[model samples]
Target: MPNFKLVAPYCGVRKYDKRFFVYYLETEENIRREYIFNTDEDVSNFSHALENLTAFMNNVPVCKKEAYHQEFLDLLLREVDHKLNIRTDPSKPSAVALAIEA
Candidate 1:
């Protein structure tokens, strides 16, 4: 497997809307991939996840395929419970509400 170098992981709010956030990972070959989030909490969580993944990549010898596969599994596991929680609890506080309280 070819080893690709990754750099410049960034996250920030979109200028047009404060509620929207964007994050991306850039590679040495200049390819960029981005994710847009509707909630600040999601963006924050993604940023933390990316940081942890980068750290793991740096310390581990795994290839990109393995790393990405692990991340995909993690996301799938998280989304299942997250979506279920939202659907099961109509009275749950939203990300916006949590942010305001904080």
Candidate 2:
């Protein structure tokens, strides 16, 4: 499974269930052209969707090295943190860290 960075801080959110959330990115070219999906789903499709939409957003036919910005970088970091259940608080150790300590 490949990882995908969130496109924006305010990437749209959907309620899959009370306990689940599906964050999506809206296409700027057209309001109706949104790429909506959930994290809990298959990662292969998720990665493909992200790559395709990102290329479109950058107005490039393929991925480029200088296409990303700070905001996008932050979004990618946050997405990984969220997936790994990493807490922002320094006082508390992450579950994985605690497990290693034990």
Candidate 3:
């Protein structure tokens, strides 16, 4: 297996064949590094893991000596909402946004 490095905050999944798919991350240097996932379950797990990793990376302050977990989670959600162009209100999200999130 090729050693892959994740250097970006964004990722994408691409279908490679009937029985295989590629999970790739866009590096900060504009390079795309990919890994193969052979099963649907593997793909799903990869997606979830990547989402959680990025969420933590984006919210946790690297320079800070200490940070509250709850505060970081709240900030992360706010950042996600802003990026998705969703309203800050507690109202239900639109169908399109929901689809995108899913």
Candidate 4:
């Protein structure tokens, strides 16, 4: 399995107006690939997990890395969950987008 780093993230509707959350990951070789979730539930779930991970990471800081690490994480989380999520959701109709819409 190739190791890839998360590069960019975007969410929106796909073909058929299906909700989508897509991440562009790049391998060390500079190969880029799309990791897409077409269902709102999957997108919501993943964002919740990512949000939680970002929060957990903030609690532990390393020497000389504190200044920029949290900023990077905040940017990453905000970008990935651009629409924002009000609560955990497991059904369709994006929890993230829905919250923003409301």
Q: Least lDDT summed over 10 consecutive residues: which range in candidate 2?
A: 25-34
Q: Rank the candidates by TM-score, best first.
A: 1, 3, 4, 2
lDDT of 3 by residue, 1-102 (tens): 222223122333333331222222222233222344445665555556545655566665655312343243345344231111112323443232333355
Q: What is the lDDT of residue 70 in candidate 4?
A: 34
Per-residue lDDT tens digits for candidate 2, residues 1-102, read 012234433232222221122232222221211223244443444445445555555563334422443244346445442232211334443332333235
Between which residue pairs do clashes occur in model 2?
none
Error of 4 at 84 (Å): 23
TM-scores of the candidates in the order shown: 0.38, 0.24, 0.34, 0.30
Model 1, 1-102: lDDT tens per residue? 011223222212222221222222222222222334456666566555545655655554544644563465367346532221111123444332233345
Whose TM-score is greatest here? 1
Off by over 4 Å in 4: 1-33, 61-102
RMSD of 2: 13.5
Q: lDDT for every model?
A: 0.37, 0.34, 0.36, 0.37
What would the TM-score be for candidate 2 when compared with the true structure? Answer: 0.24
Evaluated against the true structure, the overall lDDT of model 2 is: 0.34
